[model samples]
Target chain A: MDPISLAFGLILDPYVLTVMVLAGSFGLFMGAIPGLSATMATALLVPVTFFMEPVPALAAIVTATAMAIFAGDIPGALLRIPGTPASAAYTNEAHTMTMNGKAEMALGLSLTGAILGGLFGSAVLATSAPVLADIALRFSSFEYFWLACMGLTCAAFVSSGTAVKGFVSLLLGLFIATIGIDPMSGHPRFTFGNVDLMGGIQFIPAMIGMFAFAEVIRSVTATTPHFRPPQERIGNIFKGLGPVLMRYKVNLLRGSVIGTAVGALPGAGSDIAAWISYAVGKKFSKEPEKFGTGHPEGIVDAGSSNNAGLGGSWVPALVFGIPGDSITAIVIGVLYMKGMNPGPTVFLYQPELIYAVFLSFFLANLMLLPLGLTAIKSSKRLLLVPREILMPIILLFCIVGTFAINNTVFDVGVMLVLGLIAYLMEENGFPIAPAILGLVLGPLLEDSFITSMIKADGDLLAFFDRPIAAALGVVTILIWIVPLVVRLRRRGRLPEGVG
Target chain B: MKVNDAVPGAILIVFAAGVFQQTLGFPPMPGQDYGSRLFPQVIAGLMTLCGLSLIATGIANRHSEPLFVPAEWMRSPPHFVNFLLLVGLLIFYILVAGWLGFIPTAFIILTLLMTRLRGRGHLISTLAIAAVASLVMQQFFGQLLRVPLPWGIVPPVYW
Candidate 1:
């Protein structure tokens, strides 16, 4: 059978369809909660997916994340709190719309925008990924080394806090990655004489620790006043949504394009895409002053952009095995575990699987229409699920999830220790996403560097010998140095206009 | 609690030094010039530099920032207890779950945490929720997924 038919066969299987629907509902629940995020939802889903075939596994994640991103807007519209960071960009605008008794329109626009933009991104992914994979098939260790470095550097730089803190978190992750046996020499590095340490720290438990468990700790410790659910009832969300979408058709297109472009960049995800799209939407609007005053225009752009970004992020992940965001970082881990080893080779070896993933994106976005509307309709009761009861249950789920991966208590211990450290790290303004990216990419970065070094026989300049490698290397180096130079110049330690 | 960057910076510096020290003992690959030590050494070196930069910035902002800032939750007794209890409960599970079994341990942990967070007034509801949740989790993960969750002291029940 051809790849398309095979993909159709895989997706249309009853089991995979069941998994997608269940995952969509799960995503909507997780995303509509204020504290839980799309990344956490993916992290929590990993162990369950571990038991499934690669097709269902990837489909579950894709469906969950796409639904999660759209569902985040529900809380933003109702309670003025973004369910996920991706919805934060237009939370004010959305909440203001709710305040003005336009809750239906606000949520309606978000759902419609998300569905359209997600489809556009999936189209771009379907078209562009194969072509990129063809280009990527030519890459060697040197080129890969530069790409890995560039990805890590971008992650550190793009994080919210000081670059130094982000870099430190990344280093911490890299150091943790080195704890097991050295892949190159078959020698132990930092095992500290423990048998379990020989295999290195497992990323699954570590992810649950950092994302889900740490979030549990934060929610329990939070002293802020709880938000009340919106009093207004939502009715006929799709009513009159057509004329509004028709009016903002151009904004929708622009947001999708911008979202796909931004999301395709390594280390930038839907959160950043949403922010950029919202700002761009405001800047280009004919009535910019009305923004944050129940304006649906910015909401349309950012809402679409965030969901579109889910599809956009998969490009680099599928083509090069380099993740575009933390969620994709988890996907990369899953890919490795499944022996798919995401890269151009996956395209060559299993084109049907790749097509199935593409098809799943389409299925997920279409599923979002009904699932998202149902969530919006039931937003009040969903939001009313007390965190007190919900959190302990989630914590139990985390423990079970972590334990299920390897069925070892040692993994559970890893979760406990790492979760605390993550909590402390975040409390001190350090970003956790870069550390995740670093952990996922550490072996890739190290292996590529070591292989390239061996090929060069200790010659440093040979790293830049290849044209593509040279360009990537130069860009990566400039990213590191230019920021330092600017900082020094700002401090009067260097002459102005030195560049 | 949040601390000055200098604190974490100094800790990182010490940690990097230890990593660098440890890497010195790794032998080179038999035929290759570079060995297992090179990658770790490079990471340690970069980490050291980052640590220093953090320390420098922390010192520069010392006057404006406190050595440590207690989070608002720390000042609230209930919130502080909630934080401690959650961490304590996780550690408790790590220690006892294997011997006491998954369902009972999960039930205890969930009930205790919920009662603490939701208050004594909701004890009965907390118990009900915890019982149902633990059973559902056992069914979902232990049975359906075949995760081999420990049965410990309890008799194993099979469908």
Candidate 2:
């Protein structure tokens, strides 16, 4: 009945191993497809996990997500299309490497780096989650408000597009989040007499609509053909990977550390971690100009960071029940459903379960090596599946997947409506990820804000009374204000700088 | 079709106005200084500012080549028609899916979409794919997951 033995017994069961392999294959399929994503893969698995035990259920998600993040690079290397947003950060560099006749090397680099980063992140989670959870157990509504604010700001500012557009997308998500009954008063806010709306928008359906449905529409509407399979055969993916790994050893380690830290943050996730690491990698590289020109340096850093972030994201979710990103948001919901509410108390009550979850991260990443290489070897065949036939099947999955969530056709309608809106939003250059982050964090933000207000007797200054809250508030304010200050300062000295 | 950036901004402004007005109608809670309307109103206020900024930016760059970029497939009338038809088909499935049953409904839509998107030559192949896929999914969800996907006109097959 010790923690180690319990963890081993849960993980080593034949049923658990079978689920891991099956989920790993499913994740590979979803991640290797250009229009599918890791989030969608998780969403699709939710119904299946409903029938599983707690450990197997958690294993299903953990294995699928880790494999999906790595398999995303397969399409990016074979074709220019990125399979997931996390892979999108280095898609151009990966494709350029393929065009340069190093497809094997490119895929190998992604596979090896992802495995290393995931292992490193899992180690961090195993060591620090209990300690972090203890600290988080001391937090009140005021501290939570600042934490959520910090997360929202990070998501908005870290986007690659204009800050205002990102913020607008975020606001739209918050608005959507407000559509159900107000938690404070038990009064409906924006349901408009539809009984289904009282439950608010379903997260799984909305996510499927935004990520999968929008992509389907985009792919169907495109005039250009993208189905041409690459002529180059990928053989011995690990052949030339050693030199690249040796050359960029420090970058890989740096990216893993940076990625894990960012993933541990409440708002930031794998995509943001990949983007920042790629930018930083380019900034610090000796041959920065070689980037985006088939260079493996950035891929070594960003690719590793993206997968490492999968483990890192679990930190906050396990510690405080606050999701680190959209994936963890879904995980938190599942954890609650399984009667394993996340917090410092859970570490004491369900120590074996928590340790088993952490152990699954290790197994999933180690499994990524063989599964990822197999996916890469067969990438050409996967590409030839023909979008004309493939797209409709994906559409079918979306409809059924959305319906499976609640066994109601109402969710299907919601999916279509959100899909149309998301398509338009993306067309207008508004980023969707921040909006997703908004939806996931919106309730948390509102609950904490309202609770803090009530606790303070309507005094806003009380939000800063606690030392940790004050520090978090200061950091959040700086994240928002400093960028504006710097922009204003640059405008005044533009002529002098140019001269 | 691609529109001026100002179009989205203008739409957002109207949306924010409507939401802000609705928030004003919520009754205040007893003993609570901040009601349900407060957070929504704050969001509306920020949205208004963002919309205005987008409008200004769009107008400032109205003459840029990027702003006038082609709307891609929308310029082709047939492609646009097919896109609308697909959207309509999805709505149709949502409405009649219960009566027609999930398997038949999904199968029909998938066949029509594939034929329209790829031209009509692969109808038989598309039909087989749709039929087999729908049946497999029906068994998986209905029998395995215990989800009651409407059986409708088809005879019950446990397997």
Candidate 3:
């Protein structure tokens, strides 16, 4: 059978369809909440996905994330709070719209934009990924080493807070990755004479710790007074959405394009894409002063962009085994566990599976229409689920999820310790995403570097011998050097008594 | 609580030094010039540089920022207790869940946390929610997913 038909067969299976619907609902719930995020939704789903076949597992994640990104806009329209960071870019604009009694229109605009932009992104993924994979198949360890470095470097730089703090978080992750046996020499590095440590830290429990459990801690410790969710009646969201789409058609297209491009960049994700798209939309708008005053222009752009980014991120993840964001970082771990290790080779070995993922993206975005509409209509009740009751339940789920990974208390211990550390790290203004990216990429980076070094026989110059490797190496080095040079130059230009 | 960057910086420096010290003992690989120690040492070296930079920044901003800032929750007795109870409950589960079993332990943890967070007025509701939640979790994770959650002294139920 053709890969397309095979993909269709896989996606159309009753089990996979059921998983997608359930996951879509789960994503909407998580994303409609203020504190929970799309990443958190994905993190929490990992344990359940652990038991499923690869197709359903990947489908569940894909469906959940896409739904979550779109659903984030719901709370942004209802309450002033964004359900996820991706919605944060336009939370004020959306809330202003709600204040103006245009709640249905605001939600309608977001929903329509998300679905359209997501489809556009899926189209690009379907057409472009295999082509990229073909080119990626030529890459060797040297090239891979540079790509991995570039990804990690981009993560550290793009993360919020000081670059130094991001680098520290990244280095912490790398150090943790080294705790098991040395893959190169078959000797233990940092196991501290423990048998469980020999296999290294499992990223699943670590992810639950960093994202879900840490969030639980944060929610419990928060001293802010409970927010009274606004009670609003949502009417026909589809009423009069067409002329608005027609009016902002150009913005929608621009946003999707920008979102895909930005999301395809390693380390940048939907949140960044949404911010950039919103800014771009505001910049080009004829009525720039009208922005943030119940304006739908920026909303149309960012709303679409964030959802479009979900598909765009998969490009690097599937083609290069380098994640484009923290979500894909988890996807890579799951891929490795499924033995369909992501990269160009996955395309060659199982094109059908890749197509299945693509199909699920389309299915998910289509499913988003009805499901998103339902969520918007029910926003009041969804937001009313008090955090006090929800949090303890989530904590229990975290414990169960962590324990199910290996059925070992040791893994649960790892979750607790790492979760505490993560809470402390975040409290001090350190970003957790880079650390996750670092942890996911650390093994790949080390392996590629070691293999390249061995092949080059200790000659540093050999790292740049290959044309592709040289180009990639130069780019990675320039990213590091350029920032420092700029900083130094700025310092030099300052007057002597400036301080 | 949040602390000055210098605190974590110094901690990282000491930790990196320990890593460097440990990596020094790794035996070199035969026939290869680089060994298992190379990657870790490089990481440790980079980490040391980052740590120094953080310390420098911390010192520069010392006057503007406090050396330590207690989170607002620390000042509120109820909020502080909530934070402590959450952490303490997790540790309690980690210590006793295996011997006491998943369901009972989950029930106790959930009930205690809910009562603290939700207050005593909803005691019956809290107990009911905790009971149903624990049972549902057991059914979902243990039976459906086959997670092998410990039964301990409780007789295992067959579906």
Candidate 4:
């Protein structure tokens, strides 16, 4: 089956089409909730994918994740509360726009930006995935180990103001990752004798607990007086798409490119892609000052770029069998479980299935536009909801969602414990994002580092011998040092007696 | 409780020691070198370093305020208790899930939790919620896909 034939077949599949729209809408709904993130939605829904035909399942997951990601901006825009940490950067600006009576306009730009970026990212993925996947295929375990390390490090740093703090977070994640059966020795590293611990911490549950439950804990504590959102007298939310288009064409293009590039980087996920693009956007925007103050451009650029990141991340999975983000990582696992080995092999061997996936993604990306618009309109009511009322429901979702995965009692316990810890950590000015990243990437770094050591007879130089590995290592070091040096320079030589 | 500096420092030192001890307990691999302990030891060592750093930084920024509890959190006992109870509920649900089955356990947990949190309505909501949750999980997850749901008190029809 040729790609074109598969694509047409996917278009005609009723199940695939229905799933695309429904999942997109569901993603938007879940993303609008404070803690139920796109990643969680994707993970929880992954189990369900086992029930469907490959095309519908993949399309549903993709559509839901994409729409959910964009919908995160809605809460960020309406309530100074960001639905996902990715939207945290633009929370101030979007909320301010809402306060200033541009709620409709703010939502409009965010939706438009998300649609444009999704389209742009899909186009990039459609065109350039083959080339990038080829490059990614050249990678060995050596490259992957470093790549994962680099991702952990970057995620850690971007998540916080301090550099060492980020490193610590990555270390923590590595530590947790190492908890399960030692990939090398088959020895249980951290599980003390319980069969349940053999699998280590369930990522989805821990992620939900850490990211979602933690938010519930915070909302419970931070009793800001509930007030209704100021009514937007403006009739049209799509008030000013022209300026956004004319002014931010370059930013949008560059953001999509960056999103695609970062997304292709095996370890760098969509969240990082969005942040880096926003950094790039603000750094180069002619009206940099207008950013973070409700300029539709800022919200649009960030949202669109992040959504574009979805495609970028997918490219590696489809072609090289490597996941660029946590969500895609699950998708890769699902594909394999269904007997598809994603990579050039998947494209060449299972042409029909692969093309169906590609076409499904295309429709999924397009589907986000209407779903995003509908989300914006409905979620505006979130602003009208009382915090006390809305928060409890969100909390319910988090609890139910966490328990739904694995249906394990231990997991629910883990969620509660982690959430409590997250709440305390937040209060102490210690960020939780790095911690989650640490929990995630910790074992990957350790496994690779140790495996590489064993493979190379314990020679440290072996890590740097491979050019790609060396380059990634150098980049990681640079990422660490540059921040340290800058901070020291600003703070006047680190107060002389530092550490 | 130790002040900020002493608290983190003391805690890290204690926890790092435990980590070290745990790492040392891994069984050695007979012929295949690089025992499981090696990885844990390495991570624990890194953790020790980080812990020490936390101690140093925490002390550097220490003030005369309370050591264990932050001022903002001191006023919110109900919320704190609420959080703890939520956690407890999850643990309870987990314990009964295998025996009660996924649908029943989830429904029960949802009802009990919502009611405990002062959610409105009474038995009607609980039974309604339980029936709905059971049917949804059955049709969607169990029937549609072979993912399998738990069956304990009442045997799962599919299973």
In order, what lDDT does every prediction score?
A: 0.93, 0.86, 0.92, 0.68
A176-223, model 3: which lDDT tens digit per residue?
898899889999998889999999999999999999999998999888
Model 1, span A1-499: residue lDDT tens: 8999999999999999999999999999999999999999999999999999999999999999999999999999888899999999999999899888898999999999999999999999999999999999999999999999998999888877888999998888888888899988999988889999999999999999999999999999998878887777889998889989999999999999999988988889999999999999999999999998999899989999998898999999999988999999999999999989999999999999999999999999999988988898899899999999999999998999999988888998899899999999999999998889889999999999888888898788988899999999999999999988897778795455565
Residue pair clashes in candidate 2:
none
Model 2, B35-111: lDDT tens digits are: 89988999999999998988888898788724545558688786787678778888988899888888888888888
Q: Candidate 3, residue A340: CA error in Å? A: 0.7
For candidate 3, give the lDDT of residue A52.
Answer: 94
Give lDDT tens digits, candidate 4, residues A227-323.
Answer: 4553444356766668767777877788778877887775566677778888888888888898877676666667677888888888866775556
TM-score per model for chain B alone? 0.96, 0.91, 0.96, 0.73
For every candidate, how close is chain A to the native chain A in TM-score? 0.98, 0.91, 0.98, 0.80
lDDT for position A496 in model 2: 91
* Model 2 per-residue lDDT tens digits across residues A1-499: 7997899899989999999999999999888887778987887787678667899999999999998888888888888888888899999999998888888888989999999999999999999998887788788999889887887887777655788888998898889999989989888988889999999997778887887788788888888767577788888888867877999999999999999999887667888899999999999999999999999999999999998898999998888776787788778767876899877788888989999999999999989988887888888887677888878887888888788878888999988988888888788777777787788778889999998998899999998899999998999889889998999999889999998
Listing every candidate in turn, what is its Cα RMSD in Å to the true structure after a full C-alpha superposition? 1.8, 2.6, 1.1, 4.3
Q: Which portion of correct inter-chain contacts appears in model 1? A: 0.89
Docking quality of model 1: it rates as high
Report, to 2 decimal places, the DockQ of model 1: 0.83
Q: Put the candidates in TM-score order, highest first.
A: 3, 1, 2, 4
Interface RMSD score of each model: 1.2, 1.4, 1.1, 3.9
Q: Individual DockQ of the candidates? A: 0.83, 0.70, 0.82, 0.44
What are the runs in model 1 whose C-alpha is more than 4 Å off?
A: A493-499
Where's the lowest-lDDT run of ten residues in candidate 3 chain A? Answer: A490-499
Per-candidate TM-score against the hidden true structure: 0.98, 0.93, 0.99, 0.83
Order the candidates by lDDT, highest first.
1, 3, 2, 4
Estimate candidate 3's alpha-carbon lDDT, on a 0 to 1 scale.
0.92
